[model samples]
Target: MDVISAVGAAIRTAFDMFWDVLWPLVLGFGLSGIVQALVSHKTMAKLLGDDSPRSLSLATLFGVASSSCSYAAVALARSIFRKGASFVSAMVFEIASTNLVIELGVILIVLLGWQFAASEFLGGIVMVILLALIFRVTLTPRLVSLAREHAERDAVGRMEGHATMDMSVQGGSFLSRLLSGRGFTSISHLFVMDWASVWVDVAGGFLIAGALAAWVPESFWQHLFLSGNPTLAKIEGPLVGPLVAIISFVCSVGNVPLAAVLWRGGISFGGVVSFIFADLIVLPVLDIYRRYYGGRVMLYIFATFYVTMAAAGYIVEIVFGALGIIPSNRAVGIITHGPSWNYTSILNIVALVVAAILLVRFLRTGGPAMLRMMSKPETSGEHDHQAIAMDRSIP
Candidate 1:
């Protein structure tokens, strides 16, 4: 009974954290959907043709306007690669798509704090610049040829349909089109599809965070992070953070809540930053890279990406510290007891109603069929063709 009781408590804590951030997530994703729906993927491909500053900036803009689904980002990055975007350029876009998006910023603010959110943005920029520079220096012509060949041969990854869908409303000004029924339809599809891509990560994140928060002793984290010694902790935090993230297997916005847990438990500010950045390189994602871009290219990406993330975290920590902006108090802001009937409940009710309506629309509009086809391996060429046809037919 005690064990069951403890388990129940952990889940309850997890749900409370989810409840707190539920409304912000809905709002963020809703806005992300609208932005994604408005932009054409073809335009993005054109602007991302090279790894020059202009191209990298354009890539960042496109990434901010994209869905916050990491899988979708990977799929879209492959699409970028296939469209003749430089290899370094494609990676920069992938990094921005997952890390620099508006929804991620909003969720980070809500779960952690504004300072943390700011660090994420700053660190994200650092990561992108470093990724581009390092890849250019180290990437070989053979690796590029191999990756391009692999992309040409097999273009699909997780959330292929989600990345491929171009539901942007045509004609009229942006506002006018956004108010149209077709606009609403596009937003609904984007919302549901984006949610579908990352819901598992979100759920798993909350559960893992809750269990860790309830069961792990404070001393353990402090010891692991070397919190007793500030110098060592700062140095080691960025180094170890990614390892933890890789093993956690919870990436994307879902891991932010867990990051909050880590921060409160004595992780360095840099540690939190690197851990969040490491989501893209989680074990699952590394394997995805391997399959999508071939073994040698995947290894190259792994080394460069890991080094960049760690370096960015370390840099952010130093800058923020020198500026005296690092929050002195790191508190885990989860609800102690279960959530009460308050603003959260009210917002959740509204958000769920919206989600339900969108889900209904998704089902009625052939989303399930597309999802099934996209969920299959790259070998499913026939299904891919069918899914593409079906997507084209959608209004």
Candidate 2:
């Protein structure tokens, strides 16, 4: 009975955390879908063909406009890279897509507070810049060629269909494209697709977080995070944060809930930020990288990502600490409070209605067929043809 009760408690905790962020997730994904509907993948590929500062900037912008699912983002990065985007630009895009997207920022603000949101966005840019510099110095012509060769071989990775699908409404003003029947269909499809891609990671993250919160003792976390030594904790936090994330096997915005658990358990502010940023380097992703870019490139990516993630954490920790914006109180409400009548609840209700409407539109518009293709390996032409057919069916 005790064991069952413990399991129930953990599940309940996870559900509460999900409820708290439901509205923000809906709002973020909805906005992301709208942006994906408006922006052409081909255009993004054309703009990111080189690793110039201009190209990198455009990659960041386009990435922010893309899906927040880490797997989708990684898959799309490979797709763009294969389509002529520079390796550096492609990686930067992947980072921004997962870390700097609307959904991630909104969820961070809702759960961890504005400081974390600010740190994530600001640190994300810092990490990107750091990664770009590292790649410039370390990435060689031969390495790039090798990676491209492997990518062109089209080794199947998670979300291959999603990566190749180009559902953007073409040839119209932004508002016209957004409000058009095709635009609505495009948005609904992308929204549902994005949700389908990362729901597992999100659910897993919540359950792991809930279990950790319910089953683990506070002292254990404090010891693991080195809470007893202030100076050392700050230094160690950034160093160890990514390692924790790597093992957790959670990626995308899903890791945010676990981050909250860590924060309350006495991880330094920077540690939490680094943990969030380290989703790309999770174990499963590393294996995907190996398949996509070969073993050597995978190791290179993992090394570079880890160093930059930790550096970004350290930088944010110092800057935010100096500015006194790092939240001292770790008692975040989402971790402690169950579902209650509040603004969060009200927003969740409205958000669910909006989501239901979109889901209905998605189901009516052949979304299941598209979803079935989400993990399949396909040629770019096939993806394009299917996208066009789906759009035509809507009208």
Candidate 3:
């Protein structure tokens, strides 16, 4: 009976997460697709020029306007990095796309309340600034050379094509087209691509949340990292939560529900925030980074991001506490009853259909095929041996 009840509860939680996040994700994805269509790669390259002080800001805006998938972000960052974006700026883009996007902000506002939502944006900016400052102080020529060599190898010694808007005008002036450039077909395609990008994360997060709701023993979490002090307890959450996130292998916004579960399980506020922030350091991305930059570069990236997240999480907890905004309980239940035939269920079905149509459109359009053509194995130059050495060292 207890087991059956748990299973039922999990299903309800998953359904509720799906219901709350699906529409906002669709809107976010569309906005990203339109932005991608409009922004030229040359423009991005110029904005991210080595000497541009505004490079980080431009990177942040581009990231918020681009796709939210961590894997996709990695590919896009690599593409821009090849075109002269600084490593720091590219990292900032990755962070922004993951944390500061429209869908994420909307979901946070809806699920966790406006304060947590605001903290996410504030925390993202802080993370970006820290990354830029870290780069200024710790960047080594060897690291830069390695990244460039790997990027060139990945491109097979050629630059990848930029994402450009496909506007067909019948001999009209630039301004004439700019004001009314898109037809019905273009608008539909934009919505389709946007929905597809966000749908995967939403569904994945639901599935994971369901599993956690059903199977994770609640008692185990209450004692994992008790140090008898709130600040110390909070500080420790970031460290352990990220380790768990890395091992879980679900990147992007898919990690949110799990973070919520941790918050419910007595993990500190800073810890939950850190777990959410540490998505970039997860296994799939780390493996790709290793493939792209060899072990040394990967290690540096891991250390840099991990330390920065720890600090950010602690700072957020302190700020929120001082401001008297820290919630007494992080897990305010969203779904009280089991799934049934209702408005939310109807909407869930609709979201599923919408997701499927968008997915089909995305594959049929140029995006998926283009990404496939672009994903080539990079050679690790001098770091090839270092990669091997590092793997052995990872006990």
- After superposition on all C-alphas, the RMSD of every candidate to the true structure, in Å, is 2.8, 1.4, 9.2
Best by lDDT: 2
Best by TM-score: 2
Candidate number that wins on lDDT, 1 or 3: 1
lDDT of 2 by residue, 88-113 (tens): 99999999998999999999999889
Q: Is candidate 1 or candidate 3 better by TM-score?
A: 1
Over all chains combined, what TM-score does candidate 2 have?
Answer: 0.97
Descending-lDDT candidate ranking: 2, 1, 3
Error of 3 at 105 (Å): 0.8
Error of 3 at 145 (Å): 0.8
lDDT of 3 at 100: 85
Give model 3's TM-score versus the native structure. Answer: 0.79
What local lDDT score does residue 220 receive in model 3, on the 0 to 100 scale? 71
Better of 1 and 2 by lDDT: 2
Query: What lDDT is reached at residue 40 by model 3?
Result: 40
Screening candidate 3 with a backbone cut-off below 3 angstroms (N, C-alpha, C), the clashing residue pairs are 29-194, 30-194
TM-scores, each model vs. reference: 0.92, 0.97, 0.79
True lDDT of residue 132, candidate 3: 80
Q: Mark the regions of model 2 whose C-alpha exceeds 4 Å error after superposition.
A: 385-395
Local distance difference test values of all predictions, in order:
0.82, 0.90, 0.65
